[model samples]
Structures are given as structure tokens and as C-alpha cells.
Target: MRAAAGKYRQRNSHAIWRAHAESASHPMSEISVSATSTVDERPAKFSASDGTALTGTWFEPSPPRIATTVVVIVCGAGIPARFYHHFARYLCECGAAVLTFDYRGIGVSRQGNLRKLKSGMEDWAVLDIPAAFAEARARYPRLPLGAVAHSVGTLLLGAAPDASRIKRLIFFGPHTGYWRDYGARWRWLLYGVWHVSMPAVTKVVGYFPGKRFRLGEDLPRQVALDWAGRRRPELGRNVEEARRFRLILSRYREIRAKTLVLSITDDAFAPPAAARRVLSLYPHLVVTHETIAPATLGCGRLGHLGFLRRPASEFFWRRAAAWLITPNVGDEPKTTTQAAQSPNR
Candidate 1:
């Protein structure tokens, strides 16, 4: 009986899932890492909900051991998954399989012409997420699944139909992007970026020229329009749009995974308040929340996108791996104060 218990414990310890999301609003350069060093990464292909062939890279653990968990890194709008190669390889080094992919009309998922792309925000949230989940499950059957999302990526998970399949979730700088969530410090800048800058650029190029601005990859016209429209408080106040919003919010109940929400103190794109608001939508889930000041981590001014890169990787990334593997950290529901007590540490 003791031996059996020991075996069970060994299996259970590694058999957990983690999903991570970061708020999307910054530039991400291509991640440079040794391709054959710690992980065996290769280009992979999977089908989207509409049967569109989506391209991705899979990072499998070296030495070829059975993986107990799989990590799916979801990108924010206009940001390709290639920028997350380092993060994926890091997770692979931690003894788990990792997959990163571009959503439709972004990065490699864009097949021929960009001008004719008809995808929108809803397609990304509802369809692309489920497809990614399906691919991960197919590759690693019975293993606990995890996800990491950036910016709009987290919102997409909240809107996914297969969200319940994930056992663990971690979101970095997750926000719904409603204009009112930001404070005066960033309101004008955000307004100019969303309403003025993006509109002018999209009008000229027929899509958001995010690449030229170093905001990541260029975006489809409808995707850009959808993001711009989200700036309004009511999201157009129309009956159909209002109903759609209700539907998306209602899907949060399906996400029963234990979640950790990380917010940076100085993130102008998705501040603490915005993170808190996004968490409120998932009232049914047991979520642990943490607000980190970059100074505390010695990673000076992490802002919105710095956490994914180096410096913070020393402390923050390890903590994330720990939380993903350990289910007891946030097993019980706690208040915001209780959740902030360095449980991940």
C-alpha cells in the first residue's frame, strides 16, 4: 500500500496543467535561443475551427520522457507566437511539452494575401482557442493541459468553449481593453493609439500596420476594427452586440480551472484595476491574484511586456512553473488580500 501511494504521489505531482496569458499591447522581437540545446523544437501544423491550416512550433522535452503536462502559449492580437520561443523552451526545460502558434491572419497563419482576411476578434476567442486546445490534447492524451495567454489572449480563453479542459491557468497583464479600465496616466496615450493612430494607419494600409510601429505583426482590418470598437464602454450599445457581450461573459463560468492572475504595478496597458475587472468575470473559478512591482523583482520597469523576457525570468518564470505544478497553492477560494500573500513563492 505504501508503494502504491508513493507511485500515485509521483504521478499526481507532475500531472497538473498551466495556462498563461499576457496582455497584448507591446512590441515583441523574435526570441533568439539555441534550437537544439535543451529542447527539441520543430515546426508543426494544426487545423483551426474553420479547417484553416495553422502553423506552430512544438517544444518537446529532451531525453524523451513521458510528459504529464502540456503548455499552450496564446498570443495577443498582432503578436506572433515566434516571440515566445524562449518562454516555450524554458517550459520544456522544466519537464513539460510546450506549443506556440499564430492565430488566423497573424504570422504564419496568414497564408497568401493579408488584404482579404475576414477574421475578427470573435473568431479568435471562440474558434482559434478551441482548436489549439484540441491539438494539445491530441498530442498528449490524458495529460493535464495548461495555457499561457497575453493581453487579449486571456480574454480569448475566457471566451473559449474548451476552457474547462485546462486544469491550470496563469495570466500576465490580462485585460478586457475597455477604455474606462485605465486611469488618467494612460488614458490619453491609449486613446491616441486606439482611436487616432490605429484608425489612421488602418485606413491607409487596409489593416493595422503594427509591424511598422513595432507593436508586433500587422493585423487584419476586421481585427483592428474590432479592437478599436472595444474602446467604447457599451461596445456599440446595439442589441446584437450587447447580446454577444453577454454570451462571452457567460462563458467564464465554464472555466473551472485554478487560476493565477499576475498584474504589474506600472503596466499602463493593463494595470491592476483592469486585471481585477477581468478576474471579476470569472466568478466561478478559484483564482489567486498577485500585483508585482518591477522594482521588488529587481527587473526595473517591467511595464506590459517586460515580464516575458529576461531578468523577470529568474524569479517570475520559476514561480509560474511552481504554481502550474502545485495544485495546493490556490486550492481554496480566498479574498484578494489573502491571494496576494506570496503563495507562489
Candidate 2:
């Protein structure tokens, strides 16, 4: 009986799935990692409920092991899908299929007039995220579906009405854009530039030329307004945004998934206070929070975007891979904070 119980637990642990994705059947798309392992990258196109065309790439483990689950890598605002390809490939190597895509008006999905595109941050949450979820479900009907969202991606995930379909979730450097939540060293600079300068310039130019300024990708007018305008004591910009705030507040309860929230210690946008605030929204989730410093990874900084830049062989990357395969042990939200020290330490 004890042996049987151990076997049951092992199955529940999701240990059965761990090799990264590949496709030997399609030699043209196969990426050889070593002599025996390979990952397959394939182009995918889907449409949001609003009928907006979206393009994505699928990284799948091939030959020896079929993926037991699908993990979608949700990008932060203004970040291209390619930024996550390395991480997706890492997850594929670890045994799950991964999908990474750009939101409308960004990366591969960008088209038409930037100033004229009606895709806002809200539209991304309501339409694009769900579309990705649907795409994953359609491809792997029996496999468990999960997501790893970065920065603003968490906000978008919580805002998605169909986000509950996700079996598991990981929010990296999660936070709402509260100016006060920024690190003191970068607080006012980020505020004056993102809020005061960017929004003002966005209005004047009809779109934010972030590509020119090195802030990030060029953004649609509404996306810039929706992001940069989230400030002061209240995050809502107007009556429409006030409604969205309330809607997202409630939808957080609907997204019932085992979540791991990873926050960097000195993340300018998502400090401990901000991470805690975002936690308040997800009353129904089984959340486990961890705060790590860049020093632990032997780096000088990991402020906002640096976490994604880190090599996938690192401890935190493996931590995320383990979480993707781990099932819920309980219903409680555990803020079991830990500082991830280097393996050398």
C-alpha cells in the first residue's frame, strides 16, 4: 500500500513529463540541442474573438517523448515574442510544449496603422490572451494547459475572462503600474518618463515611438495611454478604465489556477509591496510567492527585463520548469518567501 501511494503521488507530481519539445518527423524545423535531443519550432496563426489576426510560434519536444502539457509564454507589454523564444526552448527541453506570441500591434502581430490600431491593454487581455489559450487547447485537447506571464502579462491574464482554463500559472515580476511601487532609485525617473513624458508625447504623436527612444517597442496610442496613464492613488484613467479595473478585480477570482509569483528583490516596477498588492486581487488562487535578488544569480541587477535575459540553465529557470509539472498540494495561498542563493553558495 505504501508503494502504491508513492506511485500515485509521483503521477500527481507531473514528473512523467520533463523532456523538451522536438519533431524528428519534420527535419526542416528541428533544432538539435545535442546528439539525441531536438526541439521543433513551427509557425502558428490564430484569431482573437474580435477577429483580429494573431501569429505565434510553437516549440515542441520531438521523437522520444510527447509533451504531456502545453505552456504558453505570455510576453510583457511592448516586448516581442522572440524575446521569449530562448525561455520557451528551455521549457521545451524540459518536456512541455511551449507557445510564444506577440500581442496585436507588436512584433509578428503588428500590422496596419499603429495610431489607428484599436488594440489597448484591455483588448489584449480580453481577446489575445484568451485566443492563445484557445489555440493551445485546440492543439492539445487532452494535455494540461498552463501559462508563464511576465510583467504586465499577469495583469492581462487576470483580466481575461477565459483565463480560468489554465491549469497552472507563473507570474514573473508581477505588478500593476503603480508609480509609487517603483524602486526609489528609479521611482521618479520612470514616473516622469513613462507617465509624464511618454503619455504627453503619445498624445502629440498619435502613438508612442518607444522604438526610437529605446523604451521598448513602438506602441499603439491606446496601449500607451492605458499603460502610462495608470498612476497616482488610483490606477484608472477614466470611466471606461474604472469599469475595467472593477471587472479585472472580479475576474481574478475566476482564474482558478495554482500560481507561482516570482518577484525580483529590486525590480523597479514590482517591489515587495507591489507584489503583495497584486496578490490581493487573486483571492481564489493557490499562490506561492518567492522573492529573489539578482546577487543570488550572480548578477548585478534583474530590475524588470533582466529575468528573461538570464540563461535557462539557471536555478530560477529550473524552478519555473518544476512548477509547471507540479500539481496543487492544497488550496491555500502560501507566501513562502525564499531568497534563491547560488548553487555555489
Candidate 3:
């Protein structure tokens, strides 16, 4: 089953690569990492709703105190929980209990003999996210529960109407308008990919090969398809079905939790302009916006992914830490114009 899945992913990835190659805008290369930078702490494993074990690590601050709050880190599409290790560790050291986990059918989650079919989408947003929330709440009932979601994770979390369980939400690089950014041809192609090709491919192959089939990476095909299909509507037949599950503009109003939206000025995926529009949807909610400039961080172009790649990304991490440690103080609204003109930290 794994071999079959691998083969499928290679083919699908190649097709996507071809699509990218035909475009003028070159996708950013995957970031390289130094061996010494790896966080060696072993993650504690917990069982999800289906008894699938989810892996995560707990970072305890020096002289551990009674936990005041707990923060669950939700990663973006196609990236593993480990990708946020540095940020999680930093939060843990600063006295906030942190939990980061992989979605079912992705990362270390057990892949049953069940072939990757059209059904995995139900598991990701419904089972994985809520289960993680339940597990964290179960373990730390007294502490305030908060969520920090990146990219599509934000969309998934935002799609949930009853966000009352979480006291606060920090959305890092949330994807607001993906379809608008891509060309009409690509949008149609993505639609077909998500609604038709992916479900069909998963049903036949027992898994989507887009990323999960990779040697070291454990990204699920369902998540990749959901992400990819947003661009090329032609590839997906059930665009309406996909849109129904999407974080529509109306859904933003239902996010009751105190929220913080963070966007880097150079983020290629979620530009600051689009992010500001997203922020406007949640008028009643307390929102704080900050822009990270590449010059301040001493990096050439601190694009979307670079915020995590460089440890010296103190501009983002420091502000994030301050926000977490400090109370209601950081939850204020900022306009896109203000964010742009504000001096770099």
C-alpha cells in the first residue's frame, strides 16, 4: 500500500511541478537546515479519536510553574508538526504549555490498510483538529486553551463555527484569497484536481501520492489536494463541495475567540493586503496585525517560509512571545496602511 501510494505521489508531484515550471513566477526552493539546529527532544505520543497515536513534544520552562495557559500549534498544509519545533520550544520556555500534532493519515499517524479515498477530508478538519483540542483540554483543564494556526490550518480552524472552546487564536500566514491570486486557467485546473482527480486517485491508489509518498516527509495527499485544488479549478470537479468547506467570508464573523493575525510583508503565499481584508471580516473580534520587514531581520527576503528558517527571526518570535506572555494588551486592531508604514522592530 505504501509503495503504491509512493508511486502515485511521484506522478502527481511531477504533474504539479510541470505546471509550476510553465509559470513565470518560480516557486521558492525548499529551505536547507543545519544538523545542529535540530531540536532533539522526543515528542510524547497521544491517541486520537480513532485510536491513531498522534506524536507531540512538551517544552517545560525552567522551574515549571502552574500552567496559566496552553497553546496548541497547528501547522500548515504539506508541513509536519516538527517544522514548528523551534517556535514551540520558545513558547514552552516562556511558560506556556505547547502541543503540536500531525493530522490523521499524515505524519506519524497510523495509516490503516484503507486506501486513500475521497473520505479523508472528513477526518482532517473534523477528527484531527477537534481531537487535538480535546486531548489538550483534557490534560490542562484549568489553563486557558489557545490555538496558533499556520496557513491552511487557520482556514480549517476558522471554518469551525464553535470556536468558543479556544480562548484565543493566533493565525500565522493565514490563506485568505488563494483563488484570486492564481490565473483563471490554474483555478479551473485546481477545481478539477480537488473534486475529481484527487478523490478518484485516492480511491484507486489507497492514498494521494502528492506528498505522503515522499521518503522523509509525511504530508497527506488529502491536505495537499485541498491546498492545490484551490488554484486549478479545472482539475477538481466538485468545486462547490470544496468551497462549502472553505473558510468563507461569512464564516470569519463566527470566530468568537480573541484573534491575532500575523503577516510578513514579503509573504508570497498570504500577502499583507489580502490578510487585511480577512481581518476586516472579524469586526467584533479583537485583532492585532504586525508586518515583519526583511531588513529588520537582516535577511535578504524574509518571505513566508523564512520566518521559520532563520533562528534570528527575532522580530516575529519576540513579538509573538510578548503577545503570549502578556495578556489582553496585544489584542488590538491595525490597518494594512498602518502596518506598512510602522517602523520595523
Candidate 4:
């Protein structure tokens, strides 16, 4: 596993993404996922519903045959989809095609101008995520579909179209992200960062340089502003705020797919309360919530982003794979909820 990851790091890192503009495609770029050559990872491109070209990496399952199911991975805020390469490859090895793409204004998906990017979480949901699902459905019409999201990715999923096509919805560190959702120890810090510092800094620089703070990539001004002002359902103030809110609420209510919401006990950004708040949005779904302790996985910590790292893949990735490949939700006992935790509480 270490050798495979090393090869991915040396060959297909995000630095390679810098070579091509978002509108350009790397037609034949390929990377062998492991020393045994079990999976083939290739750079691919697709367009969002708005005619915006997005960039992604497609991990093909072994045997080079058509896949019966495809897993689309949507990343957290600031973090690019390339960060989930190993996880995607793992899913591919488990007999599923996986496509991990950057949301607009992020990594390889950031086209022509960086400073003038007008995308936000709503664009990802209504445009990017839905486009990915459409692309996958178009490419493999009869295949079962699955989506795995992290952090804000889950909220984006709640707003995306074609929820009926997705058989399973897997959420990692899902949260509504209101300041009140945070624990006492981190509430003030989150409030200051999201509500105060981010807006103030973005206002001066015209963008938030998240890379400097090791948060992820630098984000567009509007993206940061939207995140900062995400405290209320009214969206505080904006022309499209009401419409975006309605779209998200409507999408969540429309979903009937089975869901698995995973939360790390030690995750400061998405504790049980925070994750459950987002789970509450899908009132008509069969949502199975699991809170895992780091020690149980033999890891020192499993924070909001830790589960995606290679070392912890065995703990969560297998379960994700089973959820994706299963014929039905009941085929796996893990899909059943023993005592369903209500988000209302």
C-alpha cells in the first residue's frame, strides 16, 4: 500500500494538474495504482450542467471491463478531489469505478481566471455534483450509483439532482456547520474563523488564501463569503439566497436512498450533534448513523479529514465498498439501524 501511494504521489499529484487549463484534457494520462497493477487511474474531464468543464480522475476497476456500479466522491471545502485518490483506487480494487472530481474554483476545475471565480457551495450542488451524476449515468446507464461525501460535500449532495439514481449515500463528517453545532471547546474558534476572520480577510484580499493556513487550497472571494455567511437559513443577504435554500431543502426532502452517516468521536468540526443536524435534512431516508472511536481502528486519531488518509482506509473504505457494491441495502447488515438516532434530539 505504501509503495502504491508513493507511486501516486510521484506520478499523479496535483502538481500535474497545473500543466493543463481546466478546459484542456489529458487524453492518455495514466497511472498504475499498485505494484501488482490491479487498478488504472487516468485523468478525465466532464462538463457541468452549466456548460462549465470540470476536471477529474477516473479509477478503473481491474479486468478493464465495464463496471456495474460507479462511486462518485465529492470533497470537503477547500480540499481537492485528488486528496481522495487512494480511497478511489481502493473502491476500484473492490470492483467499482470511482470518479473523484474537483468542484469549480478548486484545483484542476479552476478554469481561466482564479480571482474572478463566482462559484460557491450552491454551484457545486446544482451544477457540479449533478453533472457528475449525469456523466456517470450517461456513461454507464444500467449501473448502480453511489456517492461518498465529506463535510460540506454532504450538504452539497443534499442539494444535488437525481437522488433517485444513487443507491447509497455515504457521508463522512457530515454537518450543517452552524456555529451552534460546534462543541463548547471549539464553538468560539469556529465562530471567529468562519464568521469573523474569513469574511474580514477575504474582503481585503478579494479571496481567502486557505493554503497559507494549511486549511486546503485558496478559495474564491464569493466562496469564502458564502461559507462565512452560512449561519442562517435566510442566507443573510443575497439575490439567489432564497432560491438556493429552497433547492437544498427540496432536494433533501426528495431523496429516498439509503444513507450511512459516519462521524468520528474525536472530530472537532463534526461531532455527533453537528453530523446529526445534517442527517435530519433527509427525513424520508433510512439513515444509519455510526460514531467510531479512533482507538477501535488502532489509530491515534480520526478527525474530520483523517479517514481519507491511506493509513485509515482499511477501517472505513471496506465498509464504503460494501455499501457501494451491495445489490440492496439489506444485503449488508451494517445498513440496518439498531436504534436510530434522531437528529431532532
Winning model by lDDT: 2
Per-residue lDDT of candidate 3, residues 171-287 (tens digit):
787653355532233445644654566656655665566554442243355554555455432212376764654443345555566666776666666655445434444444555
- Decreasing lDDT order of the candidates: 2, 4, 1, 3
**Candidate 1, overall lDDT?**
0.71
Task: Evaluate model 4: give its TM-score.
Answer: 0.83
Name the runs in model 4 displaced over 4 angstroms: 1-35, 64-66, 233-240, 328-345
TM-score: the better of candidates 1 and 2? 1
Give a tens-digit lDDT track for model 1, residues 1-345.
000100000000121222222224533322333455667888979897788788899999777554558988888777788877777777777767888999889998887777788888888888888888889999998789988888878777888887878888888888766766665598788978886788778878898988888777888888888887766544344788888878776677667777777778788878776765566566555666677776666544777776675555445566677767655755653423322110110
**Per-residue lDDT value at 120 in model 4:** 71
Ranking, TM-score, top scorer first? 1, 2, 4, 3
Candidates in order, TM-scores: namely 0.84, 0.83, 0.68, 0.83
Give all candidate RMSDs, comma-separated. Answer: 9.1, 9.1, 11.9, 10.5
Error of 2 at 223 (Å): 0.5
Local lDDT at 10 for model 2: 7
